[model samples]
Target: MRGELTAKGRATRQRIIEGAAAVLRERGAALATLDDIMARTGTSKGQLFHYFPAGKDELLVAVAQFEADQVLEDQQPYLGCLDSWEAWQQWRDVVIERYEAQGDECPLGSLFFQIGRSTPGTRAIVIELLRQWQESLAAGVRALQGAGLVPADVDADIRAAALLAAIQGGVSILLSTGRSTHLRAALDQGIADLRGTSHAAV
Candidate 1:
């Protein structure tokens, strides 16, 4: 049941979620418990339950959304304005740096795994995030086309989809192997494919 929360109440609720995410990132979601979030946020059970009455599962979903926001947030400036090859490269590096720093601990992935990927709500969050991501990438490709850097018929959406899929796969491998080789390869291949289309158009 949603309450008409005061400003402070809203802030406290957000704090709880952020604190819980930190706990998840530091110690796997499997191990981080309600008391852990309580201690981390300095909140008592009464307040915690007031916000997340559904308990761990509900809180975990909120944290997943938070992490997903961060994934895009961290790539901003570069990701938001990819009008040229250089801009795209900057965005690519930003993504690489963010994921590299994260190492094998993908907070969003952890949330998905924790809740089971097939859960309708959780799966929708993932799909929506990917949709927005691909749209931005496709827009960047379209920008290149406008600037004569890529062919007019480059099928930006399809290209962006493939590139995004490759990046996700590369990140998976990076997590498994603790190496950046696959990430680099995926970005390189994606860029090269775009460049080829540009040359073909010329």
Candidate 2:
């Protein structure tokens, strides 16, 4: 649907999606309604349907995508540049801060829960999100190698995958326990281990 939109149409659709995302985050996926979204976005029912032909389920998927993008966007310049130990630490802090500020309420998780995680659209969103996240981490590792902070023999992809897994595990715990302890530990330990690679290379 979005692929066919003109510039103004695309902007309107994006506005609706962002508005829906905000409504979902505030009221949750289970309770939010089309009327709520319409009111929030100031969009008419016809306009909404024109943008999202399948109704609420389709809209939810769009919002899920938005939230997923935000997950990586929150990591920003720090994630983009991991050439130094300080940069890695800063990135780690941003991750912790972002999740901690979110504090157990996961808008993306809620959207997936409402949309059904196994649904093709929702699953693709999740897969793409993880793929991009892992690639960024791997790129960061590569940057370290480029800077001679990590050995040439070190496997960037493997380290990125492991670190990504650790972060996910920690986030799962945070969602369940409402604490960032595990997340902080995961990040701290992961960076520390990456730094260890530098020593071993020396």
Candidate 3:
């Protein structure tokens, strides 16, 4: 009996969570409501409250996680297989295209900002996103090293972290100014640094 009840509850909760994310995306977090989720998911008020007893705040956390998952998801394939120069370039283009298309409407960033990323839950999500992103990038750098494309002593973690930081800075500026110059520069420099085969290395 308990097992069956738990499964049903989990399903209901996931439904509400997804519904809330859609609402937040379509209407923005500031305007999302319980009814909006109910309408989207066909769930009732009772169910929403059952899943997110704290109401919109709890649901927003779930949405934040969803968005964070998407940040990594958007860069799959190439991100997971940065084993070649071609793959790294493809990953870089994917990252640029994703952000460029989004322009200023960063739903994921909006969700975190609305909920206060400094909060423990949101902060953990942010940290987890960075950790996974950096890990993938670092793996790519290590792959390059193994390919004889970079010095074997290259510190993958530092390079990846620096590259990720530059990307974030570029994105933030792009979000503010609606320009891709910084994004382009960051990617070009990051890739150049990784390539290290350039005469600039001397």
Q: Give the winner by TM-score.
A: 2
Mark the regions of model 1 whose C-alpha exceeds 4 Å error after superposition: 1-3
Lowest summed-lDDT stretch of 10 residues in model 1? 193-202
TM-score of 2: 0.97
Ranking by lDDT: 2, 1, 3
lDDT per model vs. reference = 0.89, 0.92, 0.86
Q: What is the per-residue lDDT of model 3 for residues 58-138, given as tens digits with 9 covering 90 to 100?
A: 889888998899899999989999998899899989999999998978888889888986999899999999999999999
Q: Find the number of clashing residue pairs for candidate 3.
A: 0
Per-residue lDDT of 1-202 in model 1, one digit per residue for the tens? 5568888888998999999999999888888988989999999999988998998899999899998888888989977888998998888889898889989878888889989999997999999999989999999998888888898878999999999999999999999999878998999889988898766656
lDDT of 2 at 171: 94
Alpha-carbon RMSD to native, per candidate: 1.3, 0.9, 2.5
When 1 and 2 are scored with TM-score, the better candidate is 2
Model 3 lDDT on a 0 to 1 scale: 0.86
Runs in model 3 with CA error above 4 Å? 1-9, 197-202
Q: Number of clashes in every candidate structure?
A: 0, 0, 0
lDDT of 3 at 121: 87
lDDT of 2: 0.92
